[model samples]
Target chain A: MIDTIGFDGDDTLWHNESLFSMTQERFRALLAHAADPDDLDRRLLDAERANLKVYGYGIKGFVLSMIESAISVTDGRVPARDLQSLIDFGKAMLEHPVELLPDIADVVEALSHRYRLILITKGDLFDQESKIARSGLAGRFDAVEIVSEKDSASYRRVLERHSVAPDRFVMVGNSVRSDILPVLAIGGHAVHIPYAITWAHEEAEPPDEHYRRIDSVLDLPPLLAAW
Target chain B: MIDTIGFDGDDTLWHNESLFSMTQERFRALLAHAADPDDLDRRLLDAERANLKVYGYGIKGFVLSMIESAISVTDGRVPARDLQSLIDFGKAMLEHPVELLPDIADVVEALSHRYRLILITKGDLFDQESKIARSGLAGRFDAVEIVSEKDSASYRRVLERHSVAPDRFVMVGNSVRSDILPVLAIGGHAVHIPYAITWAHEEAEPPDEHYRRIDSVLDLPPLLAAW
Candidate 1:
């Protein structure tokens, strides 16, 4: 029987990618005259590749890059209007609201009765805490871990802390890199949930046979029931 | 001088949260008949809190939980038409397309001229790999790591393998938990780019520091020019 459940935060329990999509759509519209969608996308990807050195991850760097990309793609000919759009986009993203995924609460409620729940996520401390408080789900977890990254060592630490043997634990999330492999590496079971739009940075290739893949979270209960 | 740059994926470089928001709106609407918006949200939050154990993280488990929540909230009284709406919503989410943030490619191209670039993300292997292939940005990264998680040790390993020092390295991404803190923990610098909507599962508070908070990726050239 599974005694401990490990979870990933972003794109799992809440709305995250849609806002990014909206910003991109606006960006594309802004650059319509300067470059085609393909060309603009290519340039922006190049900028992200370059900026990763100076900016680690988060919206601040992304907005900056968007501005830089606009300027570069426009050959420094970016209109003041476009620049304002970029700034406005950044501000909008910063102030965007938080929303949870469907049925997360009820399903969690059902599972909580039988298992030890832990929230394993990696992000800014204040931002994350605020979201949890806003989510109003902070009280349900037995422990909440805010780490720099999720990997074998992080999993080991979590499992050890919970006194759970690898076999008795499960890791679930949308990304293969963070959710499945590390746990599998340490002999833990993992389930993969594919999202419609995955971020380029979060991209990973999955291996066959070490873990299970489900199309939606709804399938989990039946799968776990079988297990 | 910086020779190589690594990036954290997920919320950093694309539109991610909008889909969740749409689903959330749908969820709230669906439950509006049975409960108030605030109460429904509270219930969903409660379910998410509970499921963190059995499901962990990702859309599959979330989608499942959402279905469960719908069933429970409506006491299995949801109309057949509404059931179709729920199914359609999930289908739409699964079929949702992927798009990059504005100017992302442009910034990478500019930066690639002066530094080696790599992509480091954590998630399921197949999911990440598929995204990378579809993204068409794969060629830009010198190395792409779809890691299981990110932590100080993992960062150390990446740095060691690349023969780089923490001081000279910069990690960028939307996740402070995965991107900023670990780099700082290992003596590397990180830039935080806050996103509009962060996934509750990936949520973590920010550290108390000035160097840690950044307004945008565009701010990097100025900051790093001096560094």
Candidate 2:
């Protein structure tokens, strides 16, 4: 029996990827005057991959990558005003209101009675904390772990701290790379709830295994009940 | 007698503020073409205070503030090449090698046998982790807590988890605001080690208090040995 359920914060519980997409749209528009839109898009993604080694993920990292790519694609002529626009775009993202995914509250509320609900997210500590606190759902979770990254090792360590056996823990989230694969690797159960928009960096190949996938988080309760 | 000791990561144990100062100098240079240095400096400080409300502390927040101030000071004419320079400056700050403060290792070792040593730091998750892993001093601490912020309540919670009473705890660090005041307010002991270059934002009006303030971490051993 699953005694604990972990929820991924960003795209999984709320409309996070939408914010990133909106910002990316603004970034592409700002850099459009200097380079082909498709080329600029590709370069920005490449810069993100390179900067991830140095900057990690989240709005801070995303802003830096946008600035770096703008400079390179424009050969350092991207203009200060445009860079400022990018910075403003990022600030808006940081200040954006937390919007829960459809039926997330009802689903989480139903699951809470059967198993302990925990929030496992990785990002800027303050941003994630602010989002959770503002979500007004902070009191629902039994625990919250804001981490640097989520992998099998991180999941195992978290479960170990809760004195939970791997099989007794289940993770539910949007990203296969972050939410699904890691939990499954640790002998834990998982339900993949696909967000309407998933970050490209989080996409991964399908593993030769079985795990339940749902169109939204609202479907989570009935699946867990069956398990 | 203090039974558990906590060390603040950034300036207390290593050379952290120096990197920030160097980066600020570079930021000043990068924006010099578009605005008066003194005026730009004041504006940047203002931007930092404004952004702190939304970004919190850390190298990432600092970079965003720098970019925002650059845009505002230059009236959005800061130039993309200069913006790229700013991004590189931040990357340098993140990648800079960790340099231990004078006698930090020996001091922590002497105190460890007498009291449980813990590291409490707040900043970008990956950057802090990178510095700690490379510091080669990770094993000296009994535990590490990378938190969102260090406040009275945070200290109280951490102490409770460690099964420690606030009165039995002692925190040592460089900033009076972050390192000294809150811990003292929580009925815990604090030792303020004044770094040569404390960030202006971390400065607070001198409070009436009896907590010890040492010139350096090297001075901590003898002071603690007597206690």
Which lDDT values do the candidates have, in the order given? Answer: 0.69, 0.83
DockQ of 1: 0.02
lDDT per residue as tens, model 2, A145-196: 8888899998998888678897888888888888888888888887788777
**lDDT for A218 (candidate 1):** 76
TM-score of chain B of each: 0.81, 0.92
lDDT of 2 at A70: 82
**In model 1, which runs have C-alpha deviations exceeding 4 angstroms?**
A198-210, B1-227
Query: What are the DockQ scores of the candidates, in order?
Result: 0.02, 0.71
> How large is the interface RMSD of each prediction?
19.5, 1.4
Query: What are the per-model numbers of colliding residue pairs?
Result: 116, 1
Best by DockQ: 2
Using lDDT, give the best candidate's number: 2
Residue A210 of model 1, lDDT score: 43
lDDT of 2 by residue, B1-227 (tens): 77888999998899898998889888877877877778878888898888887887888888888888877887777777777778789989889989998888888887888789989998778788889988988998988888888888888878886789887788898888788888989888888888887565666644534378888777777777666
Q: Is the docking of candidate 1 incorrect, acceptable, medium or high quality?
A: incorrect
